[model samples]
Target: MAATPALEIAPEKVAHVIIKAREYGAKVGAWNASTEEGDADEDPSAILEDFASDPTLGEIAGFIDALNDDEQANLVALAWIGRGTFEPEEFDEAVDTARSEQGNSTASYLLGLPLLSDYLEEGLEKLGFSANDVESDVL
Candidate 1:
């Protein structure tokens, strides 16, 4: 079947989000990979402290929080599309639902979802957009 038309949010805007989600995913992975044990010279609590204080995590959250309502809704819709909650043909309906359901705190909501980066990337693919350029640009 032919791919769905472009998103109201624009591929570039979605790509911007894809980049941030990727960075956020990497940080989360690193934090999870780190050992719980502390070095002889360091306090054990410091590990958790550093994880909590990670600037990259904060940047990701801040960037999402900075998005306007429409942008945030678009992100949610894209994720839903990627995650199979909606098909590509249902894109407009998905976006409409996202806008009505999102209310406030979209950043927190989106960040709370696991595999967010994967979902966003898949969503773009559903719309016939490749994430290769976005990934390269983010690197």
Candidate 2:
């Protein structure tokens, strides 16, 4: 099934976020596995230190912040659907709840989820939006 155009947040935008989240997860995994003795060419501590100052988290935060309140709420609702807290048919209710409970910082709230990428992807699928094209383009 095709994605409903009624969706407030575009599928393309969601795809972008998913890609960034995946990239961030990869960087985190690499940072976790790195060691001083691992690779001579790459400094583990330096890499980890660089990550601390990197704009990855900030970029995501900024992207999310740029969205309108309704868009942000929809994003959160989709994520909740993906996370299994709400079903696809309950999308409206999810969005309503997200809007009602929305805090000041949507970015902080979203970035805190470790499995954000997976959840977003799942949510998109449930919404009848396939991320395959977006994923390929990202690669």
Candidate 3:
């Protein structure tokens, strides 16, 4: 069966979602960088287990250490929306924009948002990395 059309998310919500995305990414990097031995694309989960139990955690720290101010902001917004941290109506607007622009619903587009380290972590999770741990230290 064909999929039903998704409701649009708003600009305000989109903005917030982007921030979360950045945060998630940054946290993952941070976790990885904290380790004595850095993780790579291949089998990074093993090292993550030793470092923070959550593989994506490294990317958060990594983001803070590596990304510039603007890039950081963008990623955070991605996570915010991904996790539903936006006003209902606003989120709808953004989703609508995303659908028209990216040919997919806002949530899906957020997941696939370019330049998001968190998005990369999502892929890692698919590879068996855990993205459950939340870093209270992260702002």
lDDT of each: 0.73, 0.79, 0.39
**Predictions ranked by TM-score, top down?**
2, 1, 3
Total clashing pairs for each candidate = 0, 0, 54
Runs of candidate 2 exceeding 4 Å displacement: 1-5, 29-50, 137-139
| Model 3 residue-pair collision total | 54
Candidate 2 local Cα displacement, residue 120, angstroms: 0.5
Write the number of the candidate with greater TM-score, choosing between 2 and 3: 2
lDDT of 2: 0.79
RMSD of every prediction: 5.0, 4.3, 14.0
Q: Against the true structure, candidate 3 has what lDDT?
A: 0.39
lDDT of 1 by residue, 1-139 (tens): 5547556666666676677666666542223447553343654433333355466567777877877777778889999999999999988789889988876688788877888888999998878778776566656
* Candidate 2: tens digits of C-alpha lDDT, residues 1-139: 3334357988778888998887676664344435422342565444433244567778888999999998999899989999999988888889999999986698889888999999989988888777787676656
Candidate 2, pairs of clashing residues: none
| Residue 92, candidate 2: C-alpha displacement in angstroms | 0.3
| Order by lDDT, highest first | 2, 1, 3
For model 2 the TM-score comes to: 0.80
- Among all windows of ten consecutive residues in candidate 2, which has the lowest summed lDDT? 31-40
Model 2 residue 6 CA deviation (Å) reads 2.6
The stretch of ten residues in a row with the least summed lDDT in candidate 1 is 43-52
After superposition, which runs of candidate 3 have C-alpha atoms over 4 Å from their true positions? 1-48, 51-60, 87-139
